[model samples]
Target: MTEPDDAVPLRRRTAHALDLMAFSLADVRDGLGPFLSIYLLVTHHWDQASIGFVMALGGIAGVIVQTPVGALVDKTTAKRALVIAGAVGVAVAALAMPLLPGFYTIAFLQAVTGIAGSIFSPALAAITLGIVGPRLFSRRVGRNESFRHAGTAWAAVVAGGLAYYFGPVVVFWLLAVMAALSVVATLRVPGDAIDDDVARGMDKATSGQHRGPSGFGVLLHNRRLMIFAVVVFAFHLANAAMLPLVGQKLALHNKEVGTALMSACIVAAQVVMVPVAYLVGAKTDSWGRKPIFLVGFAVLTVRAFLYPLSDNSYWLVGVQLLDGVGAGIFGALFPLVVQDVTHGTGRFNVSLGAITSAWGVGASLSNFVAGGIVVAAGYSVAFMSLGAIAALGFALYLIAMPETATGTDSGPGVFALPHRRQVQRDAVVGGELVEDLDGKV
Candidate 1:
């Protein structure tokens, strides 16, 4: 086990505080997002098909920035400042929505929101690495993701209630206020809690100079990484198809029935994650990431196919249970895949950004593609289609990927290059890796 050395205590306390801050912003953002489709329709009179299409288009358009955003974040000294400003921008853009002229303007604004969100995730991932290292990163991701998922669950109640009570305009105002507060809170926390001397050291050891192909091009170079990205995208596409349409099918039995069912299902799945994270934390590197991910894909595909067969809401909870198992695997392993590829590159944050942005792209495609299908065919077709995608994920992982978790790589890492081509280098941390880095290799 790696000892605390000089940085552990400082990082531990700071990580705890940042966890809370992340939970706060994530919570409100989740709340705003759940009701956004409904809000656009009810308040703005967008048709269901049109609303879904706009949401997908907005996500892709906005994330266009993500393709190159990682390079900028990796090379910049102003990461924290940029993050703080971005948080504030989220609030400002959200708040300004009520003042925007029309539906087209709202769609345009949706794209902008995606840009802000894209900046936040990878930057946050890098900061987490700096503070926690990969030692406890799973737990951190679990805690943050749970809050985010939970926020989405309850955000519906908040946004819908606010929209009904005060109007849709009130919803934007409330979300804006929460996001702005996140900015203030983030500023109060010391940036170096996660970025102290270790980052300075990391800068020396790896390509902190910010040289790389475009984010998309980087994806082209790594077959294993590309496969992982596709798996994640497949998972999200399955989700995009399920979450929106499943609710509608359930609601045909009763009004807003789908919302309650989906929320209940997601929350129950989320509740298992933190404990799973902690349990998986000690062994993630040794037990390997691929088998777990493959198993998850298989189980989730079964769950997807079975969901439509059960009409009872209580029975539906069982489907979510299976999904929870898959989610537990996904939440733990996906980051490991990204970190593995970018682990020694001094490009941890940017790599994470690129991978996550790929995830977002999956979400956009799934949402739009499924929405179009639902318009033409129906919900039965969508769920069945998700099952098919899950199968694809399972097959791809089985064929193309290998376990790259630190302790599992068998090459002696003897001929590794930090970037595209192998190059001369000494110790991984420039002279020597920290004890933890040494332990991994």
Candidate 2:
């Protein structure tokens, strides 16, 4: 079960390359982020409704393409090329934004950016799986997420400073620079180093004689996967709107420092995520996935309730720090869980994509739902409502979701069920029930 060429210099080089790829693509993947809204409203005199519409269009485009893009990643052998193309596409779209600030043109570019940006997650996960294999994937993903969060914090600081001096337009140029670095990092991941079969979740020893991927229906039939997806949807539904709601409250309370406060919230959460992600990666194998994942849900619930308890800026930011704990665990463990459930089925990326699409839907609705609650009642009610949703997600995970970490001889942790060992043993591959000989299911 060891990685091929584990001792070789090429293996070491590809590992380092993956790290750089994750770091550089951190900024490139999200495009201009909040800068898009700022630029359109401040520079172009666009109305709030119009800005929301354009942003929604891009989000919808990304959501619609997520599953299909994942299927493409699962099927394609040219993973490196796909990563390169996606990075270049995002950069091109972002670099064109300043030139074409018209409503329709910006809408189209945003859609382009969204579609291109969707490729990174599945592709990167596939490449990591391909290079390290499942035995080492948890640690590798942890490292990848750590670098990603660090890269985000770095980009935020650089973008904030540059934007302060030159204006919002400077963010676009910064995106292009990151994208170029991403392209170089991607190229450095030697194509030959990636085992295409392993990348898609096929057992490397058996891959030579393996059939193609299972039918898409197999995903729908997976009970654990379906439950996990529901929990993910609920988690995002509650988690996504909290930060934005906090920012609005800050802005209303203190107009002079609203933006600065929002930035502090973001940077604080990201900084905490760096260490949390590393901890999750390092401990997931020994601790098992269920307990660690429950901690994420539990923390989110606490964070939501805490937000309503205090309106003081310092207290709110302190409450926001809990976001790092929740998000860091979720980000690092997401792929590991997906790989665990879909192992030996050869649909890892597509499963990841489908679940991510569910996540996108939840996140998209969160803002709308939270905003309506705020208008109807108040920020306190909205925060409490979100907290309730988070509690539901936590309950779901605690009661039903099984441990996904494999090869653990140790007893289940306090949160894990005694019957956790009875994971589904048969996966449908190309319309046949293939027994999971590795017992990974």
Candidate 3:
């Protein structure tokens, strides 16, 4: 009765499938991303204010659905199906954008895309956890992010080149292709490889207890998780608006070359993210999550201030390069931290959803506030304001957030679960189930 997850060959194949899935879903998850702003601004002649409102619509919708979607991932074993459905939803909503093009229609579609896109984060994390188990999760997450960034970099290059020749409309077709590939990748991951119990943070020790997921109150009472959520919210609040603002500024300066310039900005950051993600993944276990995460917040703070210092495209794009360090760390560490905090709660995905929803609130407001500021004052003021928020988040994280890595003095000792490695060792000795500290197997 060897589990599929324990089979080395199947696990290797599953890991490869996860890599392909991450790469393909990279483009599908965000829908049109900043391209939506560029398209609306340059093609449809929409003002920044209206474009921001439309963009915010999606984030707002995602905030509303993320928690519920996370709970759904926890409850269902159909993880692959959820990924497929989400990919289809994002692809269809984005591809339809060119045809509808109207304000309300685009807003409605963006909302749909947001709701669909929310499924990927929790589902993918759950699958990764279920397959690799907790001991290897940090490196696995790093590998996943690396592939995701590479996928984004590739998409930016292709989209930039095509849009340069064929106009922004080509991005829609590109999403369609990526979405199809994502579905293929999702199908390739053997569903049996996922351990339903492990996927939601249940371990063999507690499996026979038949205890259900801890109530949401457990998450609400976690002081550290709440603090982490606030920090992340601030990060997104400052981080989200900067890039789109740069894209808009570039568009304003040179409308004909806006898409290409935006692509350059994205490609630069994503290329940096690929390696940064791998580094964070490799070092997170040994170097710990806090110090690495602090670097991200610090880098973001610096990047924001630097953006307003220059209007030159190269300067702007170079400033964008710092995004790789900041966003790369956040991407790699976010899940690991949440997993650390909610280790035995059977609420990992749901808690992740809750925090991400908070992040969504910050991001949703970012576009609106930055847009209004740009309209009332200018891009420089908007960039500086976002930079200030990033600085505050950095200060808060440096002073208050605790280290969440296991075996650390400040780890989440409240959950009362055995160390992940100990649990694994206990499960495999002599091919017999050994009792854990609680005397349960």
Candidate with the greatest lDDT versus the true structure: 3
lDDT accuracy of residue 83 in candidate 1:
71
| Local distance difference test values of all predictions, in order | 0.60, 0.77, 0.83
Off by over 4 Å in 3: 1-8, 208-218, 408-441
Candidate 1 global TM-score: 0.79
Worst 10 residues of 3 by lDDT: 409-418
How well is each residue in 1-441 modelled by candidate 3, as lDDT tens digits? Answer: 233344444445566788898999998887787998999999999988998898999999999999888888988999999999999998899789999999999999999999999999999998888765676567778989999999999999999999999999999999989999999999988776576667887664665465444334545778888899899899999999898999998988989889999999999999999999999987898899999999999999899999988899989999999999999999999999998888766778888888888888899899999999999999999999999999999999999999999842221111112122222322211112322422233
Q: Between candidates 2 and 3, name the one with more favorable lDDT.
A: 3
Residue range 171-275, candidate 1, lDDT tens digits: 677677667766765675465444421221143344345454546666787677677777788787776556555544554464434334545655666566545
Q: Count the backbone clashes (under 3 Å) in each candidate.
A: 1, 0, 0
TM-score for predicted model 3 compared with the true structure: 0.90
When sorted by TM-score, best at the front, the candidate numbers are 3, 2, 1
Better structure of 1 and 3 per TM-score? 3
Native-referenced Cα lDDT, model 3: 0.83
Q: Please state the error at residue 225 of candidate 2 in Å.
A: 1.0
